[model samples]
Target: MPDPMKVIETHWNSTPVPIDAIIRDIGLPLSYEPMADNISGYIERTDGSYRIVVNSLHPETRQRFTAAHELGHYIYHRDLLGDGVGDNRAYRTEGTNRPNANIRPIHERQANSFAANVLMPRHRLTDVTDESTAALAVRFNVSQQAMAIRLGRAG
Candidate 1:
């Protein structure tokens, strides 16, 4: 698998981090469809490659976060994926589907961190010390909460 940080760095020419381009570079196919209200998205290895499916009903920011989170599993916890990482609306990985993967909460936190890093690369923020969290979130195309968490982490 490609080093995700390197991938993000190479493709960080724009705001929002252009995750679709990253997905293409990672060779993971993506799709969006309506799903249960409780579900956010999932990433699975089908045949020999990874696939990301996002909830069509979710907000674009959420879909972006979901895709990034799944990429998180692909990067940090590939060996832990029995089937794949399925996340719920609260950003926690969980499922009752038969053959569900036994992923731990630590991985969930890692993935969340990965998503935040991907969406809000810290290097991009170094030049700015006057932006509000909401403004930064808008500039980065992430939720204010996500940016707040990121800024908190950065501090």
Candidate 2:
């Protein structure tokens, strides 16, 4: 299978990652629901189709990240779904920190990494001459913190 970053680049083919279009292209319907503030999003297979619902209460950046994170679950952990996968506070607030034992930390970490990579691709970072995380964040339509994390991990 292609890695998440490659999938985002080759399949999506746009800068700042047109995540909504990609979701739709992949045949996953996305909706914004008024979920608990701490809940980012969830994905599930229903009626032979997949749906992704993000917390509408969150900021646009958070919602975008949540969508990408949930997409990661759909791409990498579909077999692990049980009543669907719900990501809560720890997964969202903690950048790279692994979640506690009760949660599937590995899956959470993978999804987070996937979200980061998809949102701010490494190749795109290299093409940037500004070298400002904030500017890059604006360019990528992601939060500054998320951009920093992506820069730190990028080659």
Candidate 3:
């Protein structure tokens, strides 16, 4: 099995790891668009470009995770084969909410794991335990929920 921290670190240093840069790197146009209720974000493959459409409806934390999750799809899941051969699985668009949806069991888990690691890489999260979720949320420009999730996973 691969070390999750190592995988996140590798991606962080080598590519456009910053959020905006990652958005551009994936050929998505940077824009501030309002998202409807219950909609966190959406990913579209259009004109040979992958666009991540974020719904500014919820708190910032939700948007951050949504972006990272979409990026997870872009990075890890898109290239895998779908024949149940090797480690591949079918793609589902029901969203990555494990409690609500019944998408491909493994892929959703992988994407969530990827999102958690990418959004709050482990090294940076080491000292985060000293801070409250709100403090860490402010520091990361994400939500309290996201901060809690990251903290839980990192620890």
Candidate 4:
């Protein structure tokens, strides 16, 4: 399988990462569904194809991040998903302030990293003039926290 970041870069080939277009190009259908506040999104394979459904109640940024996260799973861990996957299963996004448990599964961590890399590609950050992480987050259309994590990892 290809590296998730490389796949995203090849598919998007632009700044701000046109995620919707990438999804369309990849033939992964997306839909919005109302879910619990803690739930972010999920992916499922049916008839040899995949579909992603994100929680509509979340903010747009969260929704976008969730979509990217699910895409990460679709790209990286498709084989692990037996039939369907969701927040109730092994795939789930962080909910709220939970104390450092140091128990986050590896797949979740990978998906988060994949999402961050896709949304805030390191090449784009290198060319950024503004030093503010907030500004970069806005430019990348991701949460400030996500940007901060990506900056830390990239630097």
Worst 10 residues of 4 by lDDT: 94-103
Residue-level lDDT tens digits of model 1 in 73-145: 8888878776676788876766524224467778888888888778888788886668788888898888888
**Every candidate's CA RMSD:** 2.4, 4.9, 7.6, 5.4
The lDDT, on a scale of 0 to 1, for candidate 4 is 0.70
lDDT score, candidate 1: 0.81
Off by over 4 Å in 2: 1-7, 10-13, 92-103, 127-129, 153-155
Counted clashes in each candidate structure: 0, 0, 2, 0
**Candidate 3 total steric clashes:** 2
The TM-scores of all predictions, comma-separated, are: 0.89, 0.81, 0.65, 0.79
Question: Lowest summed-lDDT stretch of 10 residues in model 1?
Answer: 93-102
The sequence of per-residue lDDT tens digits that candidate 3 reaches over residues 34-143 is 74464555555556545566666666666666667666655665554221111111124443222223235576577677776777666777765567878766766766
Model 2 accuracy (lDDT, Cα): 0.74
Q: What's the residue-level lDDT of 121 in candidate 3?
A: 67
The deviation in Å at residue 85 for candidate 2 is 1.1
Deviating ranges (above 4 Å) for candidate 4? 1-7, 10-13, 88-104, 127-130, 153-155
Model 2: number of backbone collisions: 0
Return whichever of 3 and 4 wins on lDDT: 4
Query: Per-residue lDDT for 91 in model 1?
Result: 66
TM-score of 1: 0.89
Task: Please give the distance, in angstroms, between residue 79's alpha carbon in candidate 3 and its true position after superposition.
Answer: 4.2
